[model samples]
Target: MPINLLYSPECLEYREAGHPDSPERVATIADFLGQKKAGRFLLPGKCKEEDLFLVHSEEMVERVRENSLPYDPSTPNIRGIYDYALLSCGAAEEACRLAVGGETSFSLLRPPGHHAGSKRAGGFCYFNSMAVAVKKIPGEKRIAILDIDGHHGNGTEEIFREKEGIIYVSVHQFPAFPGTGSVSFANCYNFPVYPGSSSSTYMKKFMNALSVIAGFSPDLLGISAGFDTHRTDPLLDLPLKDSDYYLMGREISSLNLDTFIVLEGGYNVKTVGNACYCFIKGIGKEKHGQETGKRI
Candidate 1:
């Protein structure tokens, strides 16, 4: 069973000069995946405004759609950003649909969106795609979201904080951008590692986070996958190697739940591709069957 990959070249249509969240982030992964033949690729469409309302307020949606917000370098209001964000969200929604149907899927698109909140956008993110995707899951299925990004998913935590039947866990660097997720509360669990933490230390925290998620006994799992923890990453100071991602993927695969992954943050173009490929290969080790979920 090949991993179902949700991506679109249109995600490369937006970019900001000198920003860490460049088009190369997704392009590198897509190129590498194609070269490796890692998975079956699928194109995704734009998500509806109603889907944005699943986790964002009407005001926020309109703000993004019409560029009504003030300028912010972290999250610039570029033209056509609303449509780009909607495309990313669409990929996430499609990935969720695949996961619930018992197929492993990964959304490899851009504008990494774990930082955008219900009412605001920041950290190079416009819409809370992961949050929106998780909300699309039907019924009372217990869901667990594990954010492995180097930066904490403050937006995701804010959206699902204390929400019933859903638990959000993050393993990230403290005192980082957005500066949240240092503590755990309600249904949101955070394990913060210090700058320059060894790979062993990071993995310890990651394992602890996984323990929390497993104890929740979730029916479905979502991974806010970010590769910036690599030592080569220009952003933060966590020293994770390439092989560690494979180990992390294997660990998550051991959980054996219906799982979906969404691209979040990974700036190092030189290494992000292989990191993503390794993680996908690790998760693809167990083949269930051909994915039958239709594109959204």
Candidate 2:
């Protein structure tokens, strides 16, 4: 049960200099993974066009393929962006496949895609990679998407709101970007926290959400793992220390469901590296059938 760190090389091909969400994020993760070297490292291939079309409309899907231009003024669309996005989507799918097969894997992809939707791309995302991965898991039943990004998972929510096969849970800062997750709903577990909220508050809400996760008995679980909530993050005001991330990952691993973790937002380099290392520690502990020690 070695921990497999899954990623795609195409991530490096799409770059946006000075952007909060940049290729450097994946580079940082790759460097850390180099240190861990826990198990077989899996790299993703290009995603099938049909797979991309499953969630995104034909127009939206082709808009990214027209070779219109590389790197949109607001977003990065490089020559390989079409392929890079496909690879990220494939990475997520492979991560989910490994989890469903009872293998512990982490998707360290780029162009963090939680913000992408059926017909739009923003927040550095070109395709809803998490949603795409979830769709790959053949199921005609309810599925739960537990998003922990600093920003609300607006795209994920928009795609799954009226759909019955998905439950989108978001715990983000209040008055945050793309604010659509605060109001409580049967299908959406939107818990908006304020800046400076401590681990105690974060954990309470997370524990409550886990109960919902249990109720859903999700055939598969997807995490939009974003570490920007760390206090030191340039964009976020929350103060989540490094160890809190390990506790979060460990708790999620305890659910015993197929868990797919697609890398999302995290600006500050220091915390992203540390938090990813911490998460890997938790996932590695789970793979070894060992206790995650404590909530360090």
Candidate 3:
């Protein structure tokens, strides 16, 4: 089956001036994927307010909807941000649905989530899209969320920690933004990499993370796909090359599990596009039973 990309042009309608989480992050990737003819693009609808409640508090939802919260430097309260956030969350839900239906899918929309928790929003996130999407899955199916963002998904960890039938694994930079995920606890397994780590070192940790997911034997896998780990990304210090992303994608695909990816971060607009394309290309290869050489 062709990979399905869940996206909507409306996700590009909001942005804070000079913010690293600019609209171009997803825009560039979308354009690149279109040019590459990588996959089929599916427009996503906005999620309901109740969907936000699945992982966030009613107060938090109301705060964003009413713009009643105080100004947060990281998560701004821009005009109509509530709707934009809903659209992004909706894309995640759509991607999850596609994956559950035996389709390979990616949600290429933002303001990147994974930092917002049950009661608060931060780190350029107003809603924890992955967390919300995972919670929406029906039944007692086991699920694993692999957060590959450079910064730890503190919010996602908090939401799913100790929760039944779900495990959260994050491989991110230590002593970085949010300063969490240094230790593993309960259902949350964290692998914190130091700044300026070599690509091989990062890949080693990534492989270790994949091992954790493999052990969990989840019925579904959700990837918080963040590209800010790239060497050129100004937001983080990890040194992952473009090819490293392809290797990561290929490794994830090798697991042969139903998977869905949600965009998290990648600030360098110039290279983020190519990075996404390479990752998706790697993901597409394995489905055809193609041997892409030895895994990292």
Candidate 4:
């Protein structure tokens, strides 16, 4: 199956200069893929307002729309940020749709979600794109969300915590920002690693988490892929090398379950592109059959 990299230059429109989550991150990855002629580039449309209601509250949506100014230090206040956020959500949905259709797709988007919550926004996120994409699909199917961001996906967990049939798993560095996912409970499982943890140690925890996920028999898999755990990343202190992403992708693909990957974090711009390429190549090795509309 041909890998489809879904993105849009319009995403660059909502940029904050010098910020860690800057447009340069996506631009760098997009440029590398373009130069290499890697995956099929696909432009995505904006997300529907009705879909925004799936995970976020009306007050939260209104706040992002009205509170254009930056209230949080990490989340910047860019003009039309709300609109750009909608676009990011739409990109996530597009990636999910393509993957469900039997195409391997990745959403290289910014305002990286996983940190955003029902009524809060931080860690450079606003709408919890992964959560929205999961909610957009019909109910009744078993779904598993594997968040590999350097920081735990507290927001994504919060949205689906009370809900049944969905499992959220996070593998991140402990004693980090938004420090909420310190232990496992209910449908959400968290594997918090210590600083300076090696790639092998991280993989052990990930494999254990996969064992738990496998028991659930999820019909669809969603990966909250984050590369900030790279040893060279400025934000986190994990010893994960570039090649680790390939291994991670290969293991996830080995499950043979329909999966979709959405961008979350990874600040080392120089290596982010390489990491993404490695992951895509690892997962795109085989053609997973097209998933029915019943699952996401």
Return the top candidate by lDDT.
Answer: 3
RMSD to the true structure for each prediction, in A, is: 3.8, 3.0, 2.2, 3.6
Error of 3 at 251 (Å): 0.5
Question: Residue by residue across 192-238, what tens digits does model 4's lDDT show?
Answer: 99988888999899898887778889888889998898888999998
Error of 1 at 49 (Å): 0.7
Best by TM-score: 3
Work out the TM-score per prediction: 0.96, 0.91, 0.97, 0.94
Comparing 1 and 4 on lDDT, the stronger one: 1
Better of 3 and 4 by lDDT: 3
**Model 1 agreement with the true structure over 27-140: per-residue lDDT tens digits:** 999999999999999999888889999899899889999987668898887899999999999999999999999888999988889999999999999999998898887788
> Each candidate: what lDDT?
0.90, 0.78, 0.91, 0.84
Pairs that collide, model 1: none
Once superposed on the true structure, which residue ranges of model 3 sit more than 4 Å away at CA? 290-296
Please provide, for model 3 over 1-296, each residue's C-alpha lDDT reduced to its tens digit, 9 standing for 90 to 100: 67999988788888789888888888999999999999999999998999898999998999999988677888878899899899899999999988999898999988778999999999999999998889889888999999999999999999988999999999999979999999999999999999988999999999999999999999999999999999999989999888998898889998999999999999999999999998998898787673345443
Candidate 2 residues lying further than 4 Å off, grouped into runs, are 67-73, 290-296
Q: Note the residue pairs that clash in candidate 2.
A: 71-77
What is the C-alpha RMSD, rounded to one decimal, of candidate 2? 3.0
Kindly provide the TM-score of model 2 when superposed on the true structure, using C-alpha atoms. Answer: 0.91
TM-score of 1: 0.96
State which candidate, 3 or 4, has the greater TM-score. Answer: 3
